[model samples]
Target: MAQDPRALLAKADKQASSARGGFSLFGGKQDKLEIAADLYTQAANAFRVQKLGREAGQTLEKAAAIQQEINEPDDAANSFVEAYKAYRKDDPSSAARVLEKAIQHYTLRGNFRRAATHQQNLAELLELEIGDIPKAVAAYEIAGDWFQSDNAEALANKVFLKVADLAALEGMYPKAIERYEGVARSSAGNNLMKWSMKDYFLKAGICHLASRDKIAFKKALDSYVELDPSFPSMREFQLLNDMLEADDGGDAEAFADKIFLYDQMSKLDKWKTTMLLRVKSSTTAPKPPLLGCIEEDDDDGLA
Candidate 1:
């Protein structure tokens, strides 16, 4: 007898329905959950064969949920990831949702590395697909923390930089500066990343200027100089020093003109351009309360 795909799908569905009924009768029994998960998996396969991607994704997600309930978190995470893959071609939002579920299950199962990977994936999806910068930053921060916990320092630092970049774009300068500074300090011993510390310090100083916190900006400049005294000779460093001097000398227009001229002449990259533009805007706008006072917040307490 020839096999009928639709008949198989219907039978799988019936099995799933029976398993759902058994949930009420069996009261969260592991065996019942296993049966349900198996039935849902079968239904998902049938749906896939029938080219019903949405149904396949839904069935797979159901199986994942049952697997989670039955304490099979690894299985649940894999199923959720499969569901995400099934939905990704047609429904990005649904795929992202399932990917988040997979991340959650992996996290709950103490699989920090897998959790961090999924978190990074979700962050990229939020940033590129959804265009949600704040949420993307939050996701990236979580991923960075997980990666750090897993001793993936390089990956963690990369993710932390992403969070800082997004925070700067969102005008969260203090947070951005803190995160950038955090990565710089943490990478102090790594030869490959040490070179980037000066750039991070420069960016953090730019963030301070963007927040109109001259004291913080000066402190950041001092910190950079302490790290690499030659920083004072760099063109960017000189530009920043000139701005601070103009601010001190009460030459607002000169400061503004200097920024404008440098902005035009430097042909800065997108990140630098964005940071400089933000500083320009802040220079004209009324300064908010000081939030970047790194000195007072820094507590190298008594030995």
Candidate 2:
């Protein structure tokens, strides 16, 4: 008479065992397996309602495994996602593990868009849950590539921007610049995103300056102008030019002045602010003034 999870799971286990025993007049083995899978799903939801997350997750995993054996990748992946949701609150690593299985299922189905989205989700879990920045960046990059290949440039750019942010934070300037440039070039062709191109180019320029490769930076600036002639007139481009001049002169004050003025017009985000600070630090000026000890009336000859 009990409707508890254990009782429901026991019923589902009986159904699954019957599925593998022999074909019956009611249904074939495959049909019985599907019924068992459906029962497992019901048990999983019951476990979830009871706040037994690990039990729910495991039950859903069993459903997913059965679905996978029946060549129902979509159902398998959906079950995996449900299991991941169930596990995330209690055991995030297990959530990530099951989510990876879902991604694999989606990839095997040639559903790259879904795969890319799950990849981004995995990246978020790695970043926010596990605190794995490098893996997060790598996951984001993979998502970006998948999105791009799927002709989902908008999604690709969004993911690539995350890649650039974390990559730059890790001092992977070249990778950041590449990602920013990729987004910038892609955005240039879209009217709605065109306005943000300057922002992307500015980020790429900042990464270049942070790398201290003046020749490459100069070349990139020229290339940007060629890529989008309007880029030369953009305030973001002008700010980068001024910052580059300040870097060349080794004048920290000049760099700070330019940044302050730009911030007045358009505030910089934390990432940009951090990168600019690194570029400003390349300057040799603004050395800390030595604390001078003033002899207060030492002329009294007290020694």
Candidate 3:
């Protein structure tokens, strides 16, 4: 007798169908995918036990494909995740592929938070593993909203810094300064804020200098000095100082001539003298730089 081979196949198919149905009981809408996944998982195990690895992988892949086609993205994502975990040690590319699938699944579901998390993971891979700066930047930006919402300001600031650095590398001074400003605004009163302000002032000063906006450059440089007196770039400070001293006969000359000569002028005296002189020289100047420094609201005008 032929031992009913047809009957055995029929029974296996029935069991697989029933397993698929069971998935719906656990969760609606995505039941089919879950059920299929479970059935495929069992089939994969049986194939493995039978020493048919290729067949096991194929069966699992079919389950994942079905879930994807049916729009059961979460289940499909989980399936790929499982497959990658099973085989990634032997093939690193498998992990990347699986993660991409998960990202797409989350994106399609409007799960931005999850998508952003995956994007950040992708950025790590692109930056450290693939050495792809543009790709990493794209991923980092994709996760920007998430970082902002999560109060991960430091990470957000770091991303902005990276953008600024990249912009500076590309010689886009305005864009770089914009990025630096973002970093400063995000830093607020934290230690990171102070450092970011220092960097921003320096970069902005350079941008102003490049544009030959002497007044703005001087202002930025002064802000930099105020923020970080011991800034690592002392040479830059000295260079700007020399430039100011070199002014032949204009306000710079007169200012330079009397610079910090006041009896009570401390090391901080230069900025004060410059401010007073600037105000005296231009009464209509909208507001003094000292306006920004004063945290208090008062009607006292430079007294």
TM-scores, each model vs. reference = 0.75, 0.87, 0.47
Tell me the tens digit of each residue's lDDT in model 1 across 1-303: 434535655665665566567546544555656776886777787777767777779889888877877788888888988887777666768989999888877787799998999899889888887788898999999999999999999999999999998899899998899998999888677888887876787778778878888887877888877776667777678788877776666555656556556655554456765566555544543432231222232243411
What TM-score should be assigned to candidate 1?
A: 0.75
TM-score of 3: 0.47
CA lDDT of every candidate: 0.76, 0.86, 0.55
Please say which candidate is ahead in TM-score: 1 or 3: 1
Query: How do the residues 1-303 of candidate 3 rate in per-residue lDDT, one tens digit apiece?
Result: 322323433444554466456444445535544565566766655655555544555556666876766776677787665564444434445555666787887777777666777667766666656666666666666676566666777766666666665555444556666666667655555763664464465455445444445776667665566556665465435534553443322343343333323222323222233333433243233443433332132233543
Kindly indicate the candidate among 1 and 2 with the higher TM-score.
2
Two-way lDDT contest, 1 vs 3, winner: 1
Tens-digit lDDT string for candidate 2 (46-102): 998889898999999999989988888899999999998899878789989999999
- Deviation (Å) of 101 in candidate 2: 1.7
Quickly count the clashes in candidate 3: 0
lDDT of model number 3: 0.55
